[model samples]
Target: MKIIAMSDSHGDRETVKTVSNLSGNAFFHCGDSELSFDDPLLEKFHTVRGNCDSDHRFPSNVLVEIGDKKVLAVHGHEHDVKRSMMMLYYTAKEQGANIVLFGHSHLYGAEVEDGILFLNPGSTRLPRGGNEATFAVIEWDKTLRISFQNLNGEVIDSLEIKNFTKEH
Candidate 1:
């Protein structure tokens, strides 16, 4: 399975559309879209509510199943991601998720700890910490291959997980 993840668009509909159009079997928007829940462009994504999103219709978190993996998606505000990922990690672990997706600080990063993958796709409209506008693609076969890419699909960083079995 291939999954495209993005977040923190901050009302830039065009960028959201661009990322959503990229090649992937599943799409996720971590939040801060600042768009209505009924927006047509958002229809393709499994989205969460950002602090900037005033619409109560969007959920604060979402759980998605892909292949044999369970992915937990959130905007990260409730867990205080700007401070630390500890809370998010524990929450995902408790939920039986193998992967945790979140966005709050507008910075792109990915890491694996205790057999779980944590990813932040960054801000496609407003990047921070010297990072460019970015998104992430996760390809799962025998391994989990994660690539952080620029708007033009150029890779900025990549990670590979060779031991991500379902038992983990």
Candidate 2:
């Protein structure tokens, strides 16, 4: 299975659409989607409310079960992501997820800890500090692997999550 993940669009529909069309796979908007609840995409998409998305009627996070994988998605702002990963880490475990996707830092982050995978797809609209407008794709198979891409669909980074589960 493949999941296209992105966050912090902050109302930039064009940027979101560009990346959205990059994959024919499932899509997850971590938060800051900044779109309306009735957005056509949300009907079949997994999304959460961001700090700016408060105007919309959606939760700040969501748990999705896809292809035997429990995935947690959040905006990250509430978790104080910049200071540390403690809050986000516990939340993922509490959610019983093997993978967690989040946004708010507008910076890409990924790691594997104690059988959990954490990922962040930086802002597609306004990236920080020389960061390119980016998004991510998690290709889940026997091993969950990640590929980070720029708006041009060029992969700028990659990772293989470790210790996230018993070999399946």
Candidate 3:
């Protein structure tokens, strides 16, 4: 399965559309989009509510099942992600999820811990910690391959993670 994850657009519809156009089987918006839930572009994404989002129609989190993997998607603020990922980690564990997808700090990063994949796609409009606006593509088969790409579809970083899947 191929999954595209992004967040913190802050109203950049064009960037969101661009990222959505990428080749992937699934798409996620980690929030802070500041766009309406009814927006056509958002319709293609599995979205969560961001701190900046006022759309009550959007849920605060979502659990997506892809193949045998369970992915937990959230905006990260409720879990106090700016401070640490500990809370989010525990939450994912409790949900029996193999992957946790989130964004809020506008910084792109990925890590594997105790068979869980934690990813933050950063901000597509206002990126912190670097200049390049970024998103991530995760290709999962027997292993997980993550490619962090720029808006132009150029890869900036790539990570191949093995043994990161939760045993059934």
Candidate 4:
């Protein structure tokens, strides 16, 4: 399965729409979109509410099941992700999720620990810790591949997971 993950767009509707068109089996928005809950572009994204999000209609968390992968998506603010991921990791473990998607620090990164993949796609509007606005694309079959792409769809970074795919 393939997945597209992004976060902290901060209301750049055009950028969101552009990323939404990328090919993937599933799509996720890790919050801080700064868009209304009823926004048309959000229809195709499995989204969580961010601290900046004033929409009560948005859910605080989202669980996505793709193939054998159980994904837990959150905005990360509620779990104080900018400081640490311990609490969020515990939450994902409790939920039996093998993949965790989040954003809040506006930083782009990915890591695996205890057999779980954690990813943050950074902000596609207002970015931090990097030069350009970015998002992520994940492709999985027997293995998992992640590509961090700039707004213009140029790959800036990439990663592959082999050992972690047993449960994915």
Using all chains and alpha carbons, the TM-scores for the candidates as numbered come to 0.97, 0.91, 0.96, 0.96
Query: Residue 75 lDDT in model 4?
Result: 94
Best by lDDT: 1
> How do the residues 1-168 of candidate 3 rate in per-residue lDDT, one tens digit apiece?
899999999999999999988888889999999999999998889999999998889999999997788989999999999999999999999999888899999999998888789999888999998559999999987778998899999999999976555482
Best by TM-score: 1
Tell me the spans in candidate 1 whose CA falls farther than 4 Å from its real position. Answer: none
Superposition error at 118 for model 1 (Å): 0.5
Q: Write the per-residue lDDT of candidate 2 for residues 1-168, one digit (tens) a residue.
A: 788899988888887778666654678888887889887755556888888885667888889887778889988889999888999999987888888999888999788877788899888988986899899989876667898899888999998754344432
CA displacement after TM-score superposition, residue 94 of candidate 3 (Å): 0.8
On residues 21-132, what C-alpha lDDT tens digit does candidate 4 reach at each position?
Answer: 8888899999989999999999899999999999989999999788789989999999999898999999999999988999998989999888888999988988886458
lDDT for predicted candidate 2 compared with the true structure: 0.82
* lDDT over C-alpha atoms for residue 71 of model 3: 85
Candidate 4 global TM-score: 0.96
Per-candidate Cα lDDT values, in order, are 0.92, 0.82, 0.91, 0.90
Using TM-score as the measure, what is the rank order of every candidate, best first? 1, 4, 3, 2
